[model samples]
Each structure stands twice: as structure tokens, then as C-alpha cells.
Target: MSLSAASRPELDDTLAIRRRTLTLGLLTLTYFFSYMDRQILAILVELIKADLKLSDTQMGMLGGLAFALFYAILGIPVARLADRANRRNIIAVSLALWSVMTALCGLAQNFVQLLLARIGVGVGEAGSSPPSHSIIADLYPVEKRASAMAIYSLGVVLGGGFGTMIGGWLASQYGWRVAIIAIGVPGILLAVLVRLFVVEPKRGLSDAARVADSSRMPSIWSAFADMWRNAAARHLVLAVTLTSMIGYATSYWGPSYLQRSLGFSVGQVALIVAPIAAIIGTVSGVGGGRVADWAAKRWGIHAQSWMVGLLKCAALPFTILFFTTDVPAVAITAYVFNMLFANSYLGPTFAMLQGLAPLRTRAMWAAITLLVINLVGLGLGPTMIGVLSDALTPLVGKEESLRWALVVAVSATPWAIFHYWRAGVMLKRQQEMAA
Candidate 1:
């Protein structure tokens, strides 16, 4: 419960720093659990595909669109509730719901059944993130937000690492179904801990600003309009959407790529990818935020966008190299740098997006941002890759086609880079005009 891992007392309200940081740790841990539940399916893809006799497109739908559609759509309304309700409770309930749904995934016998279960998982997960983002905003000021958020983002890296590793081992020892069931049950206990220990912070508490009255809360449309009107937010939407599209695609398909093209087994992938993802991913995820914070403090807030963009751009070459290479060592090595640079944007990008919102509508903005990221990124990313692979199968054969699809997915990073740089320019111009 000690949040010392995530915070320094001096950086927060001295009176309640311990309590607040502990809450952050719990929230971070919860995010970890969520990713673990969500991504375990990736490791089981081949097993599930064989068992159900499904296509790459169907698996992609299960992994991406099935879950992402409801997850993205329902988040807005759930976030609307969070802005007025108890955020801690919302998260707890969400965790419980999704955990149950994940367990249900193990029970499904057919593609349709599995698809519905995944959808249920998405629907449940939809409630967790927006409220968590809003809560984090209330716990840390703008100056420290990127760092705090980076710390939080480490959950995704670490959780995903553990998920794939454990999921793979479990699938190998038992079946994929048992593996899913085993991981799904623990979150129920954690959900209970969350309901008890996590205290909701007052809105605007970190910023030392007045909390808006609920009676005069802005309409959801008004919140959307604000984000659209804000030049920085608009660019962030495009940049994040594009970056995540490729990210989800590669992550979902990387195991298949390794097993099919590079000759790694499920267990080998788990071992290799887990450490790289845990260690290098940690570096990138946390480093991005620290770099952004340092850049923003030294140069200006707009500098954060530039740093994030450059990091993203650096990943493109490695991505291309990884997918194109036939040598396992070269491919694995390329993937390391690819993850390093590719993952660096999440914390800084999320912190910036949170900062872009008005206090009353922070949850709404988070939901909207997540909606785009999930809908375009999660919803289409893997699905697009699958469809593309299917389309290319006649030309390249089954396994090799996936490699090209992922390569094409990552090739779009340059366009995202342009948006990130353009965002920085627009942010600087906006600030100057306001001043």
C-alpha cells in the first residue's frame, strides 16, 4: 500500500501524500490487472484459432473489434457517470465485471460465444480507464503529471509482460481455456481491495482550484466540442489514434509472427517478449514521461509533443527492420529498439491529453480520447492487419502475409509523427496568442 514506489512526498500535498500515493499505486495495480486480463488472449491466439477453426480475421475481431467497439462506445457514458459518481466504486465494479467476463472467455465453445465474451470484457473495461485518469489528475499537478502518469503506464508494460508469459506457460501445460480461467479469478479479490482502500480525491484538488458544481456540469456534446475546438487536443486525437493502430496490430500479431516466421515457440515468445517488454518497455514508458516532463520544464509544455513525436519517428525504422528480417536474432533485436521508442509516447501523450481538459470534464475528455484510441486503434488495428494478411495470402502464402501486413501497419507511423510535430507547433502558437 506504500506508494513510495510511485511518488515523493514533497511533490504532493504533505498532509495527505501517503494516502494519495497509495491510491495511485492501487490504481496503477488495477490498470496492471486490466491489461493482463485483456492481453492474455494474444498468447492463446493459435490455440483458439485451431480449436474454433477460425480465420485470422475472426481472431482479429475477437482481439480487437469485438472488445474495442463496446469498450470505446460505452466509456463515454461510464465516464459521464464517473464525473458525478464515486470513481473508486466505478473502477471496482468494472474490474469485477471484466474479470468475470474474462473467465467466461475460457468457457466459450464456439466463435460466437467467444466473441460475445470478449465484448462483455470490453464493456466492463470501458468503465475503468476514464475514471482512473480523472482520479490521477486530481492527485497530481500539471508539473508532476507526466511522471505520475508514466509510473502508471508502467502497469500496462508489466501487466502485459506477465500476462503473455503466464498465459503462454499455462496454455502449454494445460489448455488455453484453463489458462484464461486461472488468470481471471484473482482480479475479483483485487476488486474487493480496491473498493475498500481507494479513496476518491476531490475534483481539482491537485490544482488547488474550485470543483465545478454537478448541477451545472457541461453536456457531453459540450465536452466533445471543447476537445475538438482545442487545437492541441485535436492533434493529440489524430496522433494517438494512428500510433495505437499500429501498436495494437503488432502486439496482437507478434506471437503468430514469431511462431510462424521466426521459429519461436509459444513458451519461447513468452520468455523473450516478457523480459523485453517488462524491462525495455518500462524504460520507454517511464522514460517518455520523464523526458516529457524535463522537456516541458526546460523548454515549454509544447516541447513534450516534439519529444514524443521524435521518439515515435525513431521507432519506424526498427519496426520495418523487425518485420522484414528473416533472421530471428535480427528480428528480435530490432523488436527491442522498436518497443523502446514505440512505447515512449503513452505516458507523455496521456498526461498532455489530461492537461488539455477542463477540471469538470476531465473524465469526459479521457473517455473521448480513449474512444478514438480504441475505436480506430484497438478496433481496427488488429482487424485491419488480419484482413490485409488474408488479402495477401494468395500472393505471399499464409505465414509470410502476416509479416507484410504488420509492416504496412507500422509504416503509417510517419503520418502520426507529422501530427505530433504539428500539435507542438499549434500548441506553441496557441500559447503565444493567449499570452
Candidate 2:
């Protein structure tokens, strides 16, 4: 029997916290494999390019836009499902689907086959983050959410590192095909673990019970309309999309840059670059989350604005240094800092978006934001860089073309900063309304 309204608050709060932690941990592991499967292709790029006789441009397509096109297009619908249905099951099914497709990448005999396989991977991964975000928002109070998300975001760095370290050794020892299989198989097992353990928390369990007085569930269309009505979310989406364009473009091309410019072999670059990038990225992601949490508590809701401001300021010079400096040590150092700053946004921005969205539409709003972010950022970033690199090759040669392309790409940082500042102001208004 349902509890009396007065007694439900304490019961729900206690149960919600427990469920949030369990589910968040499960989702984090899910992300670990999701990212590993996605990034394995980068480590294996040399072998694939050589075998398929594909140009760098084609590799960029396979890695970035081709997969991202499906991922971006499908994310919103799937996210809407998460809002309406059981998110735990959505994650479970998605995990298994992506794992099988990742294994299929091992069997690809040509670029077309690999492209199709990557597209499948994209479709599966698209199902993960939005639902996970919605769950986390319901689990944690606004003050604690950035750190929670920061911890969750660690999966990206760890996954990237492991994918590179393991993918590198496996590719070096057996072949690229075997590397793909090794990374893909583990995720299927994790799917079962998630389905068994994660319990869905009541939506908005951490917030004051006053919010429950409103409709418990809103329609997806109403939720989407609410998100659109918020100027802060709109501006934040714009900023994130622009910054992500720069970030994704650089991430896609950076390994290639090292190989082309520095003459590092696949094994060599993987060993040298992956560890550094992963370690720094993981640390920064967690650290940024903590910092955002602290700032929100001490400085108030404008904490995200401060966090974004610091990242933008830090990123500008380091990005410039990354390309212009000839010293490997200096360049790598710059790159490490660039990644650290670039990734700091993931936890804070996501937490803030959830805070802004009405409880019922949280998942849908997340999906809509991701749809724009992925379509604009993931879909175009690398492909644009690839096209520019190819076009500039005739004029400046491949090495210089890539360098210049990166320089142009890095210029998007300032735009990201402007929109983040606007989001902060909007967040204050939102918090006031909630109060």
C-alpha cells in the first residue's frame, strides 16, 4: 500500500540516495565500455587505413561524422523513451546491442564494413548518456550533482586510456581485429550486471517534496517546450555545441597529428600519448566536479559560470602552445592541460541542465541538448577538419595543413565562454524560481 504523504518524504529520500549511488556506479561502468569501444578505432587507425587503402579524410568520416550522424539523429527519440519507460532496461539493452556491433568491427574487410559497424556502435552509445543523466539528476540534490557527474565522467578518461593501452598492445601483438574483439566482449557481461542490480529511483527524489505537488509526469512535448522556453538552456546548449566542436575536432585529429608530424608509430604514440591524456583527463574531470560542487555551495549557483570561465581562460593559451611549440615535452604538456580544461565542462554543465529542466522532462531535455551537441559538434567537427586538411594539403602540404587546421579549430573556445556566462545568470533565475 502507498504510504501517507507526510511519511513518504523520509522513506523516499533514504531509498532514493541508495538507489542513486548503485545506479550511478552501474552507469559509470557502462560508460567505461561504451567509450572503450568508441576509442579503439583511433588506436587502430593505422592498420585500418593501410588495410582499407583509405585516406585520412575517409578515416575521419568513419571515426566522426558517419557514426555521429546516426547517433545524433536517434538520441532524442531514445531519450524520450527513457523519460517515458524504464531507463534501467533501456541501458541494459543498449549495452548488449553496442557490444555485439563492436565485435562486428573486428570482421570488417573493407571501409564500408567498418563504417557500418561504427554506425551500429554509435546507435548503441546514443542510448546511454541521456537516460543515465536523468537518473543521476533524480538521485542527487543540485548541490551534490556536479561531483557525482564528475565521478561518472571519469569513465571517459579511464576508458580512453585502457582502450589505447590495451588496444595498442593487442594491435601490436595479434592485430587490430583482435583488439576490437577484446574491447567489445566485456560490455555484454556488464549489461547483465546492470540489469540485475540497478533499481530506478523515483523522479526528483532529492528535491524538496514541494515539487511533487505539481504533476508527477509531464508529456514529452510539454517538457521539450519548457526547455525551449528557458533562455539559459538555449544559450548553454549553444556554448556547449561550439566548444564541443573544437574539442571533438581536436580529439579526433590529435593522434593523427602526432603520427604525421612526429613520425610516431601506432604502438609508440599509443603508449606515449594515451597514458598522459587519460591520467590527466581523469584527474581533471574528477577535480573539476569537486571544484564545481564546492563553488556552488560556497559561492552559490553561479559556480558553473566560474568553473567555465576558468576553463576558457586556461584553454586559450595552452591550445596555442600545443601547435606552435616544437618541443615534444612542451607540446604534450600543453595538450594535457588542454584536455584537462576541455573536459571540465562535462559534469557541471550536465548537472546544471538537469536542475533547469522540470522533473518529468529531464531525460527528454537532456536528449535534445545532446542531439544538438552531437549533430553540430560530433557530426561536423572532425569532418570539417578533415576537409580543411585535404584542401590545404595542396597549398601548404599535409603537415602544415593539419597544424593550421587545428589552430583554426581551437579558436572556438571564446564563443563557448560567452554562452557559459549567460547560462550562469539563467541558472540563478531558475534557482530562485525553485526556491
Candidate 3:
């Protein structure tokens, strides 16, 4: 049975670069809204705590386990669907679902109700990234992918910043309820836009001609098996998970830490700290992608891993200093440096993930990677820090307890750096073997 020429992948330059750019912009806006809905809770943490009479541990559960559990679990199936189904539709439905769930969060009268609502948000968001990643891969070639994906990745910064700002301002002005509702409802409109405007691309359209024809989609178990067998993939998964743990913990707690420990009000945290961190995050996220693309051009496939590893290593000292310092200005400056380096990996790391994966299994590989990341990072990061904070409260009091707990989170960066280094080395070897 000879494969037909028509079955072989031909570069479909049918999607113009401008269309690709527009698609990226639209998807990035979708991602931005997705993250904003998810993270708005961070800025509203204190208000929720006060109203619900909740402990930090409980708050942590809402932030991490409650949301991440369903999110991580459902991502596999959703990504599986994305592999075969219409990705744009999956993303549109997901946007609407999460937006509605986010609005419902405002209506919850108790912790359990709120927890369920957050869980709903998680389930909705699970449908977003995998398909989005797959689409981006189809839209751009390997050389230009990191930068394109980096633009999409700005959703993280924009959403986080806007979530904090809008959530905080709404909470301050009307209440947290209003804030949640305000942020959540707009996404439903965006979902409609997605359905109307976004055109789906043919799989493998952007790749070079003569690709192996994978007529059948791989099973989920096979995806897991592939990752387990590949040393570079395994290490990359662990590396991102560790870094995400640190990143999630910091972003989730930073608002409370600043308010309680540094004597900043919610307004101040929203207006000053959030904006500063957002700016740094935006710059680093975009710059990292461009730098990664450049590195790949100059070096090789392994260049991205090295870039991520070096950034992680460089960010460590600043992270520790941010946690240890008492001076407001110095602490904020340190935090700025941490933010700058902390997010730089997202563009390159994801680019590497997309590149390393088998084309047929790309979305599932992303889902599997995210499952580990969210389970360990979002699932445990906040909860662990909150538990640690509660444990140290009697001895050190609230402020110092939170400070040290953050330090504990930051301590994990070194472990993340090690894995990144290993992934880089393995990637180089893997590339060598291919060559």
C-alpha cells in the first residue's frame, strides 16, 4: 500500500500571514480573558476571606485544588477532542462555559458553593490552551512559532494584570461580587466573536512536504507512554511543573502579602504593584519569545531549553531577596526582577514542547504536560504555601509567617533550574541523534 502524493503534507500557504496575525490576535484576546477569569480570584482573596470567615488553608484550596482538580483531569479528554474535532468550536464553547462559571462565582453564598464555581471555571479553561497551541503550530512554521506563541502568551500577563486591577477596583468600589461578574461576562461575547471570525487550519499545513502520514490519531495511553520513554520530555515536564508551582504560588499570594506585610492597601496593590509586575511580565514574555526564536536560528532546537534554564537560574537570587526583604521599595524592586525572569520561559518552553511532540499527538502532549503542571503547580502550590503559612503563624505571627512561606515557594526554583538544565542537555543529544 503506497501512500498517495495527495496524502503527503504540502505547505498550505493558503492562510496569509495577515490572517495568521489576526488569528493570533483573536486567540490571544481569548487567552487573555480565560486567564483573567481564572485569576481574578487572587485579587479578591482578602475580600472573600473576610466575608466567608475562611482560613488561608481554605483559601488555598479554592485557589489550587478545587479549581485545578477538575481542570487537570478534564484537560486530557478535552485535548483529545481538540485533536480530532473542530478546535475553534472547542475553544468557543470553553470560553462561554468558563465565563458563565466565573459570573456564577459572584453568586456563591458559602465556601463550598464558591469552590464548586471555581471548579467549573477550571473545567471550562481546560478546553482553551491545547487547541490554541495546536492552531498556533498550524499557523506558523518552527522558526516563527515561539514569537507567535509568545504573543499569545501575553494573555497571561494582560489577564493577570487586568484581573487584579479590575477585580480589585470593582471590589473596592462595588464589592468582590461585582468585580467577578464584571470580568466574567465579557468573555461570552468574545466566544461569539471566536466562533464567527476564527477559521480552522488543516493539520500539518505549515510543516514541510513529505511528512509521514499518521492517518489515525494516537490513544491517550500512547501519548503518556511516549512522554515516559523520552528523557527530554520527562525532564521538560518536571521543569515546567516546578516553575509553575513557584509562579502560581507567588501570583496567588502576592496581593495579600503586600497588603498585610508591606502595609499596602488593596488599591495600592492593584494600582502600583500589579501594574509594575504586569509591565515586567509583558516585556519579558514577548522578549523571551523573540530571543528564543533568535537563539534557535543561531544555535539549534536545544537553544530554547538553555534560554529557559539560564533565565530560571538568574531569577532565583531575586526571588529569595524579594521574600526576605522588609523595605518596601527594595522588596518591590526585587519582585520586579523576579517577575522579569520568572515568565520568560513560557514562550520558549511551550515552543519546545510543540516542536518535540509528534504532530498527531501535539495537542494531547500539551494536555498531558499541562495536567502535570496544573496538578503540581496550581493543585499544590497555593495549598502548600497556605498550609506552611498557617503552621508558622503561631511562632512567627501572620506577616512573618507569610513571608517565610513565600520563601519556601521560592526555594523550589533551584530544583526547577536543574531540570531545565537536564532537559536542555537531553534536547541537544536528541537533536544530535536526529541530525
For every model in order, what is the number of clashing pairs? 0, 0, 0
Assess each prediction's global lDDT (C-alpha) against the native: 0.89, 0.83, 0.88
- State the lDDT of candidate 1 residue by residue for 1-435, as single tens digits: 468845653444454455778888889989998889888888888899999899999999998999999999999999999999999999999999999999999999999999999999999999999999999988888899998899888888888888898899999999899999998989999899999888777788788655555668899999999999999889988998999888889888988998888888999988877778889999988888888999999988899999988887788888899999999989889989988988978788889888878888899999999999999999999999889989999999997999999888988999999989988998888778878
Between candidates 1 and 3, the lDDT winner: 1
lDDT of 1: 0.89
Q: Where is model 1 poorest over a 10-residue stretch in terms of lDDT?
A: 8-17
Q: Which one wins by lDDT: 1 or 2?
A: 1
Give candidate 3 misplaced runs (Cα > 4 Å): 1-13, 16-18, 209-212
lDDT for model 2, please: 0.83
- For each candidate in turn, the TM-score is 0.95, 0.93, 0.96
Model 1, residue 417: C-alpha shift (Å): 0.5
Q: Which residue pairs of candidate 3 clash?
A: none
TM-score of model 3 (CA atoms) = 0.96
